[model samples]
Structures are given as structure tokens and as C-alpha cells.
Target chain A: MKAATPTGANIALFLAGLLFGLGLAVSGMINPAKVIGFLDLAGAWDPTLILVMGGGLALTLPAFHFILKRPAPLYGQKFHLPTLTQIDGKLIAGASLFGVGWGIAGFCPGPALAALVTLNSSVLLFVAAMLAGMALHRLLLE
Target chain B: MENFTPITGLIGGLLIGCAAVLTLWASGRIAGISGILSGLLFPHKTDTGWRALFIGGILIGAACFAWFNGGVTIEIQTSPGLTVIAGLLVGFGTRLGSGCTSGHGICGIGRLSRRSFTATATFMFVAIVTVYLTRHVLGGNL
Candidate 1:
């Protein structure tokens, strides 16, 4: 009657994103100025973001353990796990670039889009840059 | 929306994480965000049903939140054209990196995948450094 956990997975992912977005909105993390302020430790640093992240982690950890104990999942057919190791230039380079982009914009793609709903100028810019970044990566890869 | 009392992040994370696990268990998929998005980007002939539905679900979810919560507070601090460009760039970057934060950090790392772990770590490092450079070095706190 049902396909796979796409229903659940998709729903979950969407909901998760919603929550993530909501967090940004509520915590004011979506604001580049606030984010920059947090980063600006030497100046007026606002560490509220740490609390938001911590709260998310707290909720996720227990759920993660509970789900893992199950032999299988209801929506998904198999446990989607990964198996790989080793760090290289791609890893370092990607991270650095991502950080730089994030720093400049104070908005990652996820949060940036969420912030877009707010109709802020900085968020808009960051989102534009992010999409461009994604396109460029695709060309180079494929 | 601003009036809504935010749920404890722990609760939100729980709901989201369980949904992710269930999807993996049911679909035999890794909950790789990039993969799902990439699918949308490069659609295959036979993948219309679930894939389309999935994409629909994402949009629906966002809309639902905005509607039910009285629409989110959109803060467009930047230009519309630029934001779109950023999104494109992110799309490219995810493709290049083979995964997004969700895939690498949550799904991949959860399963002890070396690649995911490395990727997640790299991404985090980059994000941190970017914050420093933008807020401290360049002072582009728009």
C-alpha cells in the first residue's frame, strides 16, 4: 500500500526544515546583524545561538538513540548509513569556502532561505550567492 | 507567528530526528538532502511519482507553516536577484561536495561513515572560519 519512507522522510525533512527555519526566525539567528554580533565576540557578542543549537541537539540525541534501537524503520526499507573515512583537499577546501561564504553573508542556505521570508536585504543577498555557488559546483562536478 | 511560543528545541529535534530515522528505515535511503535536491535538478524518467511528491511536500510544509503561523516574518536585507544567485551557488556546491549538511552531518556521520564525518567536519570548520573572516576581518556585517 505504501512505497517507502519517502512519505515519512519527506515529511520529516520538511518538518525538520520548518523547525530549523523557525529556530532561525525565533532566535533571531536569521538576522545577519545578530549573527555578525555573535561572531563579533570582541564587540557586543550575543551567544543566544549556542542555546538554540544546544536545544536542537538535546532533542535530536534521544530521538536518534530510540530510532536506532528499532530493527527497521516503518517508512524506510533499510537503515541509510554511511561507511567512509579519510580527509583530503576537497574536504578542507569545501569547508573553508563554505565558512567564508557563511561569514560574509551571516546566512547559510537553509537559514538564508528562511530569513528570506523575513524580506531582509542581507538574507536576500546571501541566498543569491548561495544558489550561484550551488550552480557553479554542479558545472564543475557534472 | 512571533506570538507563537517556540517549542523546546529538544522536542523539535526529537520529532525531526525520528522522522529522518523512519525514512531511512522505510525507504532504504540515507536521508541525503543533496541527493534529494539533486534528483529534482536532474530528474530521471521513472522518478516522477515519489520525487515530485517529495518536492511538493517540502513546499507544502513551508507554506503550511507560514499560513498557520500567520506567515513568517520575511526580512530581505539584500537584493532579490542576488539571493537567487546564492541559492544557485549552493545547489552547485552540494553537487560538488556530494552531500549537504544534513546528509553528511546527520545521516552519514550517524552511520559512522568516514566520508560523511570528514565532510561534516570540513563543512563545520569552514563555517567557523567564514564567520571569523566576515565579521572580524572584512567587517561585512550587513
Candidate 2:
């Protein structure tokens, strides 16, 4: 399969990022309080997050099924899908840790990055620490 | 719940799904925020350029939405210390886990991958429990 030109691929990547950030902002995911409200199942229990996930899955589920059937993507030479299939301790442990952090702060990586546009001090701090954490993981694990 | 916002959430989620589809089709990449950000931090020769452009697009996209929509609402309830701690956990955990919500939750589940299913279940369960502990048991406003 012939890959698309670099310029075409770069433009698509840029547009994808744009759409992702815009979507996060519009969905109110950028608001930590909204995320906390959804996570607070026993409390007020706002269900907006559920709809968000549902909506995302609605499109992605069918789209992925159809797209992967192709030998290659429209532009890319090959799909870079993950190869691992096992369920192991590392996955569970890491997910658990991430869950704790997400519940505590109501900030995941995507919304956290999108929220940076607001230039909020806490957002800045979290992103910095997040980068440091990534670095630490590489140093300690990889 | 009074805080429920179905329309915006669905629309936003669809946008996110579109972004994921576009990225995969054009560049054969998963639109996983953690992976993208980490790749930028630890740059590779051919990969760095696209990652940078994508992230820059995210920032600009958010800014554009804020500018056009009279500003998006954002509420960060976590204290600075807690935010930092949470950020660290998320960064480290996502890296160790090999994916986050976008990667595993949306894309992985869309592909019907067993590992993604397990990861999503684990994180969702743990996050629910965390909210219970922080909100009910500890009775903290975090």
C-alpha cells in the first residue's frame, strides 16, 4: 500500500487534534467538577459522562469495524493497532493507579491538556507533574 | 440529574470519535493523549513533528472554542497538592498501563480487544470506589 504524502498525513493529524480538543471542550469534560459529579455515583449522580462515552462508542464501534477491514488506511501504509492480548498485573495495577488519580482530581490526560487553554494555575501544575511522572516511569521502568 | 447535558455530551463525543477515525485513517495512529504527549517528551526522529503539530492544534482548538463561545466553564475543585499528586499518578499509570481512556476505553473497546475491556473495567470500578471513599468514607470535598 502506498502511504500518503507527509504533508497530507500531517494535516490530518492536526485536524484530528483540533477536533478532539474542541469535542472535549464542548462536552464539558474540561470541567473537573463535571467529571467528579459523574464519578459520584452515590451522590447527585450526573449522567452526562455516560452519554459522552456512549456517543463516542456509537461512532467508533462501527467505524473501527469497517475501517480495519481494509488492508491499509486511506492514507497510511498500515494500521498501528496494539498487539498485546494478555490480561496481566501490570495492566490492572496501572489502571488502578490511574483510577485513583482520576477520581481524586477529575482530570484525565485529554481534558487536562485541553484545559490548559484557560491558563489556570492548577492545570499548569498538574500538566507539569504529569510530564515529570511520565519521565519517572521511563527512568524507573523503561 | 439537573446537571445532565445530553446534547452537548453526545455532540462532543461524536466529534471525538471523528477525530479518532481521522487519525487512524490518515496516520495509522491511535489518538491516545498520553501516548501522543509522551512521544513528544521523548521525541523520535520522524514522529516528533506530527506529535508537536497535533498538540499545538489541541491548544489552538480549545482557544478558538473559548473565544467564539464567550469562554467555556471550568471548575477545578481539587487543591493544588492533590492535583499534583493526581497528575503524577495518571502520568505514571497511563504509561505503565500502555493506554488511557481514549486509547483503551474508546478505541480498544471499539476493536473488542480483551485487554482493553479488562483495563476499562478495572479503571471504572476503581474510580467508582475511589469516589465512594473520598466522598463518603473520608467525607472530604475532594
TM-score of each: 0.69, 0.96
* Candidate 1 per-residue C-alpha lDDT over B33-100 given as tens digits, one digit per residue, 9 for 90 to 100: 45565565555665444544543444444455566668654433434553454355455555556666
* CAPRI grade, predicted model 1: acceptable
DockQ of each: 0.29, 0.72
List the candidate 2 regions with Cα displacement exceeding 4 Å: A1-5
RMSD of each: 5.0, 2.0
lDDT of 2 by residue, B1-142 (tens): 9899999999989988898888888877788888899988887677788888888888887888899999988898778999999999999999888888898888888889998899889888888898899989989865
Q: Which regions of candidate 1 deviate over 4 angstroms? A: A1-38, A65-72, A116-129, B1-19, B25-32, B46-65, B68-89, B112-117
DockQ of candidate 2 relative to the true structure: 0.72
